[model samples]
Target: MTRMNYQSARFLTSAPTLAQCPPDDGAEVAFAGRSNAGKSSAINTLTRQKALARTSRTPGRTQLINFFTLGDDTRRRLVDLPGYGYAKVPEAVKREWQRHLADYLRGRRALRGLVLVMDVRHPLTEFDQTLLGWADDQDMPVHILLTKADKLKSGAAKSALQQVRSRLREWEDLVTVQLFSSLKREGVDEACARLDAWLADPEPA
Candidate 1:
């Protein structure tokens, strides 16, 4: 286990402008996914704190990039990206959100990894493929979390994971994938374990 603490974390907001970001000293792990993909739930589960990321019954509630700081002011952060593929949001607003998201993803120097959450029932939408492609172009490590696994039986969950793996094999970008359910508390520790390993190592200078 990594000898670290997750203390004093909070949701900072829906978007990231130049003035609203945390200092860029430490590595950051960002979360990107479709709306209602259980991102808020996964984030809360990871931090072991309820309401830390503000779950919404409605998709597209998170319209901006939310940032959460972990383990003191040493600069480690968990970034929550705006949910894509939600049809209810205005086209203009979604476009703006996409612009900001792309700029951040392509340009941020402190970003170390991205945790892409997708619904297990409908994993790997077209938007997901584009996001994975963007990450691949940047040579970023991606960890996919198939959320809402509790909605299905073990057999179904296994099959779903295998399906995602097969789809990923077609992509030239190699991304690691896992299954999780916030309601069932499944794969939470394993997800944290992987993140801990990444965060424990210092970024190459």
Candidate 2:
């Protein structure tokens, strides 16, 4: 498996332009989810860095595609997609954001897989389903990370995981589901393992 260790964030850029993305190297694994999904915290936790991916107190702070290189000089790009579902953003701007997000999701040829982070308390939502549908249409591999698992009791967390699994299993398209707790440092290795496995696999034709 390809070992993943966050080296540093090279730069942060908008999605419509990919203004900060590194030149094409191998493949990019993107993190996509709603605002306040604990994405930044989870990313920092996974990388074992306290403040690698900036955690925003306000939702929708990340308005673009933020790129971070992992490992050494020969590093893979970790794309942090802008958070969706914030009602405060203007409609016109939201649509424009969607346009950029859609363009990336629809056109990025080197996209290997997606890390779909959902709040464990809420699991999946309508918007989440739409994103999953889009990924299914593209035949992209998706790994769902149920974030904030530590907030729940052990039994509750297990039950939620099963519930999410059953719901995903019902879908015609497949997805891998895992629990994560960035605050408690739980499941970080598991998340990394999934990423490693994908990185080690042969590229799709």
Candidate 3:
């Protein structure tokens, strides 16, 4: 595959449930985070597009699992998973999405790695740790983006970064953490480097 031109990313499809997702036969990296965590903003910044991934004030506005192909190639994709947090949706629907999200995380063969976005101010939540555990179960590598770094002072952001690292020390070999600011376009290259390595891998298993 040619090197990913993230700028070329465009929406490919959206699936309401795992069963509706695109064919499970290619390399993809999924971005997931809690509500209002700036996952969409990080994606937009990374792709150099203002609205490549929808940004909303309302959390979980789109419960669909959105997929975007790199440079029009379906084999390489970026997935925007539904954000976790307070939503106006029904409990049953939330539960259903959770089931499928877990199923996808645990079994999706095409997934190369996971990009777990999080608010730098609130590094790891209970749900975040739960997702990390799932990643661990499948031996999937995770690169966490502590988004909204711009919200903190230079020294404060670094401190938060260190705290997250310290907490995740046990999973150091499998998880990588970094401070990110979609507003400042910071850490884009570092995140890209990790994504490139994962998406370009010849064999996933």
User: Which candidate number would show the highest TM-score if scored against the true structure?
Assistant: 3
How displaced is residue 182 in candidate 1, in Å? 0.4
Per-residue CA lDDT of model 2 for 1-205, tens digit only, reads 5575554445444344544455555667889888878887887777777776777777886787877765553346678888888648788887777777777777777678889999999978887887888888888889999999988999999899999988888553658888899888888788888777665543544
Which runs in model 3 stand beyond 4 Å of their true positions?
1-3, 202-204
Candidate 2 lDDT (Cα, 0 to 1): 0.77
Estimate TM-scores for all models: 0.90, 0.88, 0.95
Model 3 per-residue lDDT tens digits across residues 27-80: 999999987889999999999999999998888887889999988678889999
Q: How many backbone clashes does candidate 2 have?
A: 0
Worst 10 residues of 3 by lDDT: 196-205
Each prediction's Cα lDDT score? 0.80, 0.77, 0.90
On residues 50-111, what C-alpha lDDT tens digit does candidate 1 reach at each position?
A: 98877778888777678877745446778888888884878898888777777888878888
Per model, how many backbone clashes are there? 2, 0, 0
